[model samples]
Target: MRIPRGLLAFGLLATLSATAFSSEPQWVEVRSPNFSVVTDAGEKRGRDVALHFEQMRSVFGTLMTKANVNLSVPLQIVAFRNTKEMRQFAPLWKGKPTEVAGLFQGGQDRSFIMLDMSIDNPWSVVFHEYAHQLMNGNLEVRTDPWFEEGFAEYFASIEVDNKEARIGKIPDVTYQVLQQSGMMRVADLFRVQQYSKTYNESGDHRNTFYAESSLVVHYLYDNLLLPKLAVYFDLYLNQKKAVEQATQQAFGMSPEQFDKVLRNYLSSGRFKYYPIPTPPAVVPAQFTVTAMPLADAKAVLADIHLHSPDYQEKALAELQEVLLMQPGNAAALRGMGYLYLQRQDLDHAAEYFRQASEHDSKDPRVHYYNALLLNRGSDIAGTDRMAAMKKECEAAIALDPNLADAYALLGFAQVSSREPEKGLEAMKKAVELSPRNEGYQFNLANSYMMNRNMDEAAKIFRELARSNNPEIAARANSELAQAEGYQLAAEGAPEAGSQLAGPSDAQSARASNQGVSVEENGPAPAPVPSSAPVHFVKGKVLAVDCSASPKAVLSILAAGRTRKMYVENSARVIVIGADRFSCDWKNVGVAVNYRDRSDGGGDVVSVELQ
Candidate 1:
């Protein structure tokens, strides 16, 4: 099932003995290179969560091809020590009301997994549901229910430490149920969806379903059937073929035949086991203390409460108190940005959002709101306004894939920039994620019109024109008129123009570019010539840190030992034919280009995934 609602309480470390008795909950927020983790479970727990997810981030790159996952969206995890601890601080989702050990949610702008740390094995629940979230958010297409659940359960049994990941060996209760209940028919398994009655049946039958599905998954992929499985997923996912048809074509076996083979295989004692003897070590991109004072806690609360109309005044008062203590609090800055945005003060809003981004570069919400500010703000001279907006929106989405507004903004920019088909897809996803959001729906209609799908655009506009909200209705009516040949605007071909749009100072300063002012540590280093001897290093990436303001470091395991390579902030990152933004250096199996430095280190110029 997507959520195991009945399993109550998550397992959290019992590290801080004193905080439990405090009158008010003291919160700690940990920022990793790839994650923003908040916890009332204390700083120790917060750091522990960061370390765990960081390890998972490295392992995940190996789990699938880099193309299959969206590493850009920073993963968010909220793990409270227990239900009692969670109740003390109301998180995005209040889990105290229910018994679920954990729940994972994926959105257009962000994805998060909430875990209750009270359970004996909370990590299992985390890995299980996280697998689901990752697959859903990252995969280009929806996976079949049988395979999806099976894949999740398969990973749920993983056991990991600092140095290694032991797969397929962890004990699973489902395996015992599978042994006792025996095998299930393959066709029946394929027909079961998460919402299916069989899957939710209140008995051992449901357990059997989960167990058998995972067993089949293990047999297919773990038992040297990955190539066939990959072909099946390709046909089933990207190609959008019927499941039975894709399966037949990819595996060359009917469901019944596969069932017989699976049964025979299960009867045999042979099952796949995998152990990574030298798995990548977990390294925090940037490690810093996450402890906060009570005033700052209130600031974070103010930021959270700003979203609710009823609590705006209360939050403003809280922010006033917080800013009095810490003037540069990112949360307070973000709150001010949001307030200005609500008041339609675009310039001030943009400034505040930018300030917030500068203060907290790892915070996805900061980038998300900043992107919104950029989209609503005036165009800059040197920047491709549409491209800049799209880039910020993409970065926002990369940090939080579930953020509907980011997708909406990117879709609008894509349509404005004349990528109609791509715009239509993004806008459609935005509307799907937030059906009640009028802006997303309106942009989707615009995208359809841009793609010249007048009929679909008209349908959406017609529906929206009936809404009781006057602003939406008026805009929809106007769009409907345009869709129905009202000649609101005439199309024109693009004239020749300069393609190399320069980045703004703000854009240049971001991690993607080398615009940060470098501090002079000593005498100016001699510049390497363009004709300098070039060297290549091909190996698995052990670590990557672009968090440094003016430089990025990559640690690659090549020729046995780890080699530290320094990359200027301006170094280009390429991922073959894929979009450059999707290229993440931390991923395994990247190729690096560099010049051997005089100090024995390598100065990397470019990193490519080919």
Candidate 2:
């Protein structure tokens, strides 16, 4: 399982105690082509940690038939020399640290994998989490919980040596667990969602669910039925077919039939594993090992604490100590700046970030932090502030070209500064760097909207509306409604355009401004047309007189008075919440936007059914 940062409060170091830092071990950093491992378990262990990740990454790329496998966010691996050290970072359960060999903690900007080197096989836990990262990075579509967890479990058992790597080997514990707990029905297992009680609360049912899920995946892999899963998912999700029906169509088996097949396969006592030659590029001997300074190592740990919730005070204390020892430490300064930024102390954050930049101007993260601080404090109408933020973002990008967040911020700043084309380009670059990042994708959609590409923006919004993340889905739905309105307005529907343009125009301006300015300044005022003013009324349609074939006049009860509204062409008049305007309509609830006439009547622009 991927632990979300700050969700668990391991209160092991609630105070700034000397015991926590008195016996600080020697920390070494191992750098490979694609990963970094920081460990106090000697350089050899650190190198091994980095090599294992490289091997797994290689395997993932090979399996996905891609040359490179990207982790959307940066990852730092922390290996402890013993379980006692590892327990300090473990999740607390019943007021004590949960016993675990390894764990993965995820964050927006960075992720961490913690390991206990004393364990005989800590690889499985970390590998399982690493597989999830790989899946998130590689897969565009969200899949069922069963497939995701089962695939991770299967991939977790991977064993890589110097010459070869083995995959698809089932762990013996899975079989033992299933045998003792019995298995869930195939249909029941398939119906399990991420939030289902069976998947969330751990017990016999959960264990059985996982065991059966892994078994199903193993069977599918062995039978070469994995490729057909797309058909199954499409039929079930998009086509809205029943699970049994979709499974039958895709795998030539009903739920009951699959259940029997799985049980038979499990009882057959035959399991297959695949062995592939290890990629020559993963040469552990080629990796560089460097001794990390004590303060720097502590600073890294402090940064982890900063990311984890309920540890801010501890993180702050640690950073202060590190700075006290070495005030010019750039990493420590950056950590302090970020901690302050998280607390919304913009002034202090700026000060620390400035000092960090002065010490090490080449640090991309420091530049990015400074840019973030500037963006957070910027005035929406101040073009100079936006330009400064953009410059900082550009500097960060120059230092580290793959910094996606910097590009994202630059895009927002550029668009707000009225440089829509440049903003769109920067947003696209951010998405290109981190394709799986939904936030970047959202910004990219907004950029498209600023460029007046409503159709493309709406397309992205529609997809995002189905996201598993509620916040993203809610925002996407809101934007999608506005985008649809804009689409209708763009299609020469003047009445609809006038009615919908009010909120959307303001929202578009604020969208470019992003979160900072909008929160500070609220939304920009809606633009009004210099032509005839539009008036709105909501009431019941009393009657419609259509003595003229094409033209009609409706008597509406609004504001406790009867008013007549004229439609020059009833058939052509804009009608919302329905297919077309009705000539003989009566007693229907409606909202109308119109232009006032000289005779105390009104010329109807658009009518919306309520």
Candidate 3:
């Protein structure tokens, strides 16, 4: 259902000059409850765009039986007056701009939907991408590429009128394409992945893949077999069953039999669609429209370029131009700060963020960016610095309560400051806001570990160890092993290196670790004693001296100071969040727990790659 960015960029350049306006078009911003539409297509079209999105969002929630359908990341819709203007923003192929009726660009902090208003109906392509975003926000588990794309295609044909919305209507072009380029086997279709050549390449085979995927979903919906999809996925993914076996078990038929049935259904030309009354929440009359300054509008375009890898320089130029016209423009300042942040120029990023904050104290993004910059800096070991980061995160959350990233960062800061209970609560809130984010889930697990809740931590890590993302899976597996070790230690196992001789002995050990004296008569019930008093530091590894083989020395930059940490045995040292420890590691962010050495340095206990 998702069109490749390359496809959106592949068309003749001759059509670029087809439409022209007699006078410069005015840009306006249309605001609804859940969406923002910035357009040169007049207020009517802008209001219609906002209303359509609100209606679609409501319909998605109703169909899924979800109470909230809001996306975690902010989205901005840009409606160009004509194809000519839209072409200018399209992705470039071989140094030339490619034509497109609509394009969707996704990012971590924000997303964009650009439409060519000259076209009568430019919603299909954008709608497909929109469906993917909605699923990402609502679904807890990642589904197969086939199901994901097929379901998006199934919902992409949604047509809305004043009273109701019609869904599941297949376009005639799909049938024509599939007929011309014969379908693949059902098993092969099910096995296709996002990285498969057939999914990435542009050809008749790819066209047929999309068309057949949609037809299969349509068949499932019409036959009332949609509920069985969970069974199929559980068999294929969790049980590790083959595509053919899972399909046979879930659909009550072999792949070959299902193929025949699907072919017949396609040939019979009989399909059903769903009609549901529009929710009353979507009211176009209540939407607000206001003229936006040209400089500010250009800043949004610059932000779009900033998120694109190929257009960073153009983004800088546009931001500079905006600043020249309006020196104190808050949006432009924030964009500049983000641009510098992406480039890893921390000083400039900090300065721009500081200026932006002063100019617009109420902007949540400025506060969020400040927090992010602090998190990425090397001086976070200072309590005051960490408190500043937490304050920024708190400000951002107060401004935008649904900002999941702010809660995530706040949780990290709290954990680093040794406030495990507060960290756990903040991390839970983050996961509640963005349930599908594996990274947030990983952080939540880490928070549980800090709170000494090993069972909960291990459960999350076990689930994440099976993730499709290789990095997250590797990290989860490593953390899962550590969590198990912690659980054993908590149970007073000798193998975990924390077992005490007796309860009195454990109290004495805990008092010794805490630098307190034990009572002469009898000590009160004491918590389990850890290995030793370990100091935590988060910073960059400046250099590694491995001249001593197993006993390597590390130069780390923490709290704006260089500290020397000695590793007893590099091979035996505990490493988390990475597959293996490397003596050559340098300039990478890392968190270390170490004990103070007699030489005024540190003896490394564990290292966590950040």
Candidate 4:
């Protein structure tokens, strides 16, 4: 009985009260630089688990370094003392035993693990699932099953104590199965696809499959085939060639010869357990531990569920109960801030975020959300709003250097304020921390383009265009077409302030053709080219004269002073959030191209709402 992460749903049990579980157990969170461990197993036990995971991080980090694979992302773990406690929290189990030691749930932006601490050697289950989470993203769409499962199973036997690791040892079950069964041919194992029934379900074939996969991986490691195997694996994952072809190219050995060598190695007993040299002392991520009431923990769960749209209703219900029990809860407040932001009620969202930030000033997430609201408001409020957003982002990064999204938000603020180079560096750091995050990737790509590194920009854009997500793919293609000097047909109107990149030279070009038009059906006349160089300026509309119908004169705040500019009736007009414009200038906040004319006044070449 496996509870798929995608299917694991929870809601407030309508009839249950926080007091119902008050006497059962209490939860506390132990945090490390790269992992968070939440458990009801007492403070000492929680700290021990945190340290254990930190040790695992060091061990795995070293192995991945040797293999030249970068699995860099913080992880979270939720551990329960027993199945009963797990059911109370998870709700989807409906009081049934999950029959598993641990479960790993991965998403495009993050990953987490849930486990029963009472299970025997639960660390092994953690290692196995962690391996899957790491490999799932980097391994290409065409990765070989033998290598995937074999590599995960091989790492599952890791044992660490005080910085020393005993590696390549077989699990008891694998050892037993191997001792009872005949060696599987390498060719047959290599041909096994992930969807094969034997690999996915229970049977004698599945048992043998695990044993043989582990044996082959150990064999490869013992014979020093790891480097070549790593290259072969990378090649296959990158889809550079078929697995069979990559295997031959990487090792220069026929499948039959490889099989013979593996069988001989297994029989020779040369593949034995080995010990890693003592690792350097690791400074774990520091976290504060407060004994949280059951209701408070439930609030945190509600916050987590709020990330998925399907769970929002349930999250709201849970949050209501949480607020009932603990008024002014930081988590619940932040969750409401998120809900209001989604609804585009910026005023309410800002109020909630400000309250949450005041409640927990040191919390990185609160600051992050505050930064988001401030950034959105910057479009209408000018430089001061942008400065505030920058400060909030800096606060978040200072509190949690590993919060990748904070870096991204900081990057956006930097770019909008006309410091493209500084923005690019921040965006790069964000991508480095969470390479699998498409949003971060998109920001990095856009930053690169803004910095005039077209080659790098095009490379990322091409990759994004091929993404599995339709909307992302469409956006990527649109950006790529623009990069290549063409335009994608507009898809309705995008919600204002939606795209990661805001008003810039590049974005101004796209907006000129994308949204603002005199008539809905045809292209508007191009803005008059300034014989003199043009400068980009962001400001709120001070006043507009539409008495002259086809032509309008506008006064706006640019560069700390009021500048009047002539706006031709043919000028491109765009509203950021609404996507379309009615040519009315009321309540307009815009980024415009200011061109100096021979008459000693500036004329607007393009006017784009921010």
Any idea what lDDT model 1 has?
Answer: 0.63
Q: What TM-score, computed on C-alpha atoms, does each candidate reach?
A: 0.53, 0.76, 0.83, 0.65
Of the pair 3 and 4, which is ahead by TM-score?
Answer: 3
383-403 in candidate 4: lDDT tens per residue? 566677789899988987877
Greater-lDDT candidate between 3 and 4: 3
TM-score of 1: 0.53
In model 4, the Cα lDDT at residue 200 comes to 91
Per-residue accuracy of model 3 over 341-456 as CA lDDT, tens digit each? 87667789999998999899998888989998776654545566668889999999998887889998898777666677898899998888788899889989877866778799
C-alpha-based local distance difference test score of model 2: 0.78
Estimate candidate 3's RMSD in Å: 10.0
Candidate 3's displacement at residue 79, Å, is 0.8
The numbered model that scores best in TM-score is 3
Clashes of each: 26, 1, 0, 5
The digit string of per-residue lDDT tens for model 2 on 1-610 reads 9665554333334434556666679899999998989999998888888888888888887666552377657788999999998887777677677899998988877789999999888998889898888887666567899999998888888887667779887788888988888888888888898889999997888888888888888888888898899899989877779988998999998999998888888888687888877577878889999999998899888888888774678889999999999999999999988888776676788999999999999988888887776655533224556667888999988977877788988886676565778989999888776766887778787677767787998888887888888867877776666566556545645454444434556654333322111212222222122134445677899999988635789899987999999986564355656656777688998877666789999887667776
Runs in model 2 with CA error above 4 Å?
1-24, 378-381, 493-610
In candidate 1, which residue ranges exceed 4 Å CA deviation?
A: 1-31, 40-45, 67-72, 87-96, 105-108, 180-182, 199-205, 233-249, 264-270, 277-281, 284-286, 295-329, 332-367, 370-408, 417-610
Q: What is the C-alpha lDDT of each candidate?
A: 0.63, 0.78, 0.80, 0.65
Ranking by lDDT: 3, 2, 4, 1
Model 2 lDDT, residue 489, Cα: 46
